[model samples]
Target: MTIASCGSVSALTLGLPNSSAVPAEKATLPKGLFVARIPVSAKTKQRLANDIETITMLSLLRPSNTRLAVGTRIPEVLAIGLRLHAKNAAIPTDIVELIAMQRKSGIVFVCVRDADFEGTKRQECAFAVRRALPGRAGHTPTFKVFVSDWKPAGEAMLDIGDPAVDSIDALWESLCSQVMLGSASPTALDARMTRRMQAAQLAEQIDKLTRDHQRAKNPEQRNEIFTKLHKAKNQLEELRKLEA
Candidate 1:
């Protein structure tokens, strides 16, 4: 019921109940929210995406879609799907709660390759998510989930439908179209990317100013551009540190 964790920007739309339906007073359900920190890296996104696509395709190709039922909740369902996909790929994710609960809001998904998914990967992902969260003081219950060590590619392809998009690509597109995982991770990444872009623009401006300052013939003009350049660099540094 409208479960929310502190500092989580990623909202979960799990066909879940809201406060009105589940109610805070009802003590029947779990108390704490689980925050999944997914630390997705740019290096391994394509590989991970392909693997997820393959698993999803295989699942769909199964005679019965509901063969590996996990739970009714969207996260739970996806978690089970991920587990199955990971198992097939020989990937391992060490976490007690496969799915994050509502109590924690921040989940970091990192891109990982098959070779680097083991050891302290989960801790690293969680640390990354915690850094992404706004506050450092609050006690938001959290957990880590690993996406590393996923299969390199699917076993095979099946042309089940009409429009001729590659099955892997199509499956990936379908996963992105989902409400929870789709919106949460991508949206956070989008926000982060936007900040990075802004910082880059500021850095570019500072560089231009530096060049202008050097080219300036007059002392007054040189000093003015230097001041502007200094301010711009400071701003860029601040922007970059927001992620840290």
Candidate 2:
């Protein structure tokens, strides 16, 4: 498995043969495994519309039905394929809202497909992991969401024909790493979220400052805006470095 970093999101490339041969409707898991075709309720679709332009299909992958009893810690896993209108579609910014709409407890992997002006199909895949944090007496539980970048699609197909337990275990293990299920500490994950938010805020601030600097006629005002923009950019770069 090779991971390529694209800004904040990382693309996972599982070097497997015949991955592209399988159709989207086919289960990626080995034959005889429990792959259920679950319905995407109208209400769910409407909620997802906030972030996604269109949803093509949603399927549930249950490890409990397998003979090997994999994914003991995870209750459910979702595979979703979406069609977006945006040419360069990345993971949705408000992914937490999309997670909140889910009734099950587990990770979500999305395959986004869109076409350029030439009508050539382009696909990208990403994963979203959510962890529930303990809340105060009166407050509801808060969730920590970790999203990967939309990478070129291949591993997202998950089309594994091997039924061997070792193969399945290795596959699940790779997925577990993506969500940082047991590998990452809560404090570490929280710090990541903080940095992500800070970076977004700083980027927005820099954009506004740049516009203000451009509009300002007075040399002193322009100089002040430039100073602020430079500071914001420096802070954002530090945050990106930390993420890397």
Candidate 3:
């Protein structure tokens, strides 16, 4: 846990507003639980994405979110969220690297709100977000954040415990005492997210090919995609086993 003074990482993730080179001073004691909630009176409502970010910043301030529940739709918040939640915990190096890699890879989940959320299903997605409880994933113990938001994409529910994501909360708690913003405009998306979107699109292509092979009337095409899918499934299984 102390290999690389994680206190610096802590400072960066929690919006200290200092440069990376600047060292952080010891934090003062906590005051009280300050949740931001917006009451609708003169204003109709704020933009979803902006509101999500504002609330996210508030949740990360204290760094102890065990009792806090954050909700957002922004994907950029994942890196910040992960870092914030990871500060006090002892995460293994492999998981830490994987997190850093995921942050670098920028792969994101897009919630599919269709009535038939195929990606959100247990078997389809390979993991059950709601059932994972809190603060970990698998025997590997992926670092967890307290504000767990379930994003239903297809049949797979991308368990977005990260506060950085905008698609996390369906409804922002009005009295939450924070600004609101969810799933910002594409302009607001970071480079990491853009890359993630590209990767997702590629995954979709592969998925279609596999499904087409399954549904193909022609035996040749069906065999082609089926073979590919079999290889893919096996590869994913191997990766999971490694993570496990």
Candidate 4:
């Protein structure tokens, strides 16, 4: 999943709000800024392993009384952050499980980070949206999850030395734009992932066929390999076009 760039604004420039201004040692968020400081249990921490040092819920956004044109309320949005043990630590992949544990719905803004170094920090921030899948008769319902690319945070603000209120507000606006535009909808991201996987598999198959064609002593075997190679190349080309 990757962030769909908007006009002249780069994705990284509009990444999640830097939590550097929020002290790491304290779980408390800015006064009157957040809704609550949801606790992270020891068992949950164990499940995440040492990859994440802490998980903090900064705020929650709910729909207002006003209804939309669709006559439905906007989904709830959760702003959360995870402090990682190191820069290379894996970002959490089990978003569904995480959301289920929290008993929350709708969109999630995730910010995963490592401690600062040389006045710079390593972070991965993205928005994850969940969609319910249509269930078959007598079958259980499932869900499709879409995640925007984990964009680097605070690069443009590095020289600023500290997180400013305006910068933080801008970050929130960028995040809101993503949700409002539906840029990271499940169908679009899922299709892109499927195309990428197909392209990769085709490339690997073509490479193997090329090697097999060279090693084949029989003319018939070589011709068969060549045919398969041609077909794979065409398929790959089609996928590339879809990507573009």
Candidate 5:
């Protein structure tokens, strides 16, 4: 992927064949991934652009067996990017769509935790990414770092844990190490992800039943929905317990 000027469309370029033609298990190379969103504060926007640039440079220098070119950028590429970065403001549909995009491109996402997570957000976000694997929603790997920790340190002389982030060269070295580690171990997550996926499915079913209950015009229909809703609620409770 080549870096464009800030606010310009970012494009991902991989050296591998079009991923669609190859079986996924055989495609071991990595693709650059960025998530941007609308209505971000100026600080967030600048941070996003900087991060994208860093990813672009890293992608360009990526090793031969490790760099995979997916394709040229499409218009909705930015929208999918937005969805991944929007977090709480992003709905399930947006997340589902973003997951689809990542899966299709065989790219790994990079995300930040909340603003208050401080230097620990990178590890926290990494765990979150690992936890997301069982949903079968996407097939992309993710590497996370704590970029939300920017508060003018003034003259405090900070004791930064990963000083590599202080410059692009150092940061790329860290990222390359991460990619070499490969995707989160699906085997380790299998049992947990299975339970989590079931819980998610039950939650979605409960939501649908509640909506149906609200939309039912007749008392008979409403009663039917209520019965299904009650059953779904119980099932969801069980699923949650299993996940826990």
Candidate 6:
């Protein structure tokens, strides 16, 4: 079963039906299709997972690996092991359905990590898998399930290993932009919008200077480069806002 929410670049994985035996139905199991303007809800989440399972299973007839995520936050693990199906194969129709089913099987994992896994190796990943599989598997694969340098292009299929990643707002004056757009609300979009502006501007400066010694032509060009450097510096001076 192939499940997808196309609008956002999501790195979520839901463990359900093994993609190997699931059947495909084109009308229901569309891959990466958009569901624009639909408000998020419990029911909607369940439905999406179901659809994706169908699609995932549909693809399984071709001999793909049974992979899924186990969202965790041990700081030692990335996503965990499980099979991700596109069709509504192994997935329950609702949160209740899933939880209820867990008593018979196990908890359903939902991955919510970003594109990068922060930098964990295969051995570390194996440890993570062992941690999750306390007593489930009777026959573990010979090869430890881990990637050396996996950088996902799409949220595609992934294991939502263990809970959310521990993110902290390590506010440093350094990352903040030097220029304040205004005394705007601390949570306004206008203020927060400058964050990326600041980051990009800073990135360009770093790149320019690193290559400046190699490719930068002259001092005048360098000064122009520096001017942009500061603008980039103040790109995120404003604050963030939430209207809702």
Which candidate ranks first by lDDT, i.e. highest?
2
Question: TM-score, each model?
Answer: 0.29, 0.45, 0.25, 0.53, 0.32, 0.24
lDDT score for residue 156 of model 5:
9
Model 3 regions lying over 4 Å from their true place: 1-206
What's model 1's overall lDDT?
A: 0.34
Reference-based lDDT, residue 97, model 5: 33
Please provide, for model 4 over 4-104, each residue's C-alpha lDDT reduced to its tens digit, 9 standing for 90 to 100: 22111222343322322223234333312221345555655454655555455543333231121211323444455545556644545453345434443
Lowest lDDT sum, 10 consecutive residues, model 4, at 156-165
RMSD of each: 18.7, 10.0, 18.7, 10.4, 15.0, 19.1
Model 5 lDDT per residue over 1-244, tens place: 2232111211222211221122223322222232443333465445444322222111122222223222332111111112123322211222223334443222222222223344443211220111123234466744332122222212101111243333323323233233322322222334554565577787898899999899899999899999998998898788677545
- Model 6 clashes, total count: 53
lDDT per residue for candidate 2 within 89-178, as digits (tens), equals 655534334543445544444546443535675556666555554345688867665666555665443432333323234334344345
lDDT of 3 by residue, 1-244 (tens): 1111121223233232223212222222111112123232222232221111111111222112222334333222222221212111221222222223333222121111112244342211111111111233345533321122332222222222345323323212111101111332223223323344444565676687776876789888778888887776665555445323
Off by over 4 Å in 5: 1-51, 55-188
Global CA lDDT of candidate 3, please? Answer: 0.29
lDDT value for candidate 6? 0.29
Candidate 4, superposed: residue stretches over 4 Å from native: 1-45, 59-74, 94-96, 100-104, 115-151, 155-193
What is the TM-score of candidate 1? 0.29
198-225 in candidate 6: lDDT tens per residue? 5556677766655664576788887776
lDDT of 5 at 149: 20
How far off is residue 118 in model 6, in Å?
14
Which should have the higher TM-score, number 1 or number 2?
2
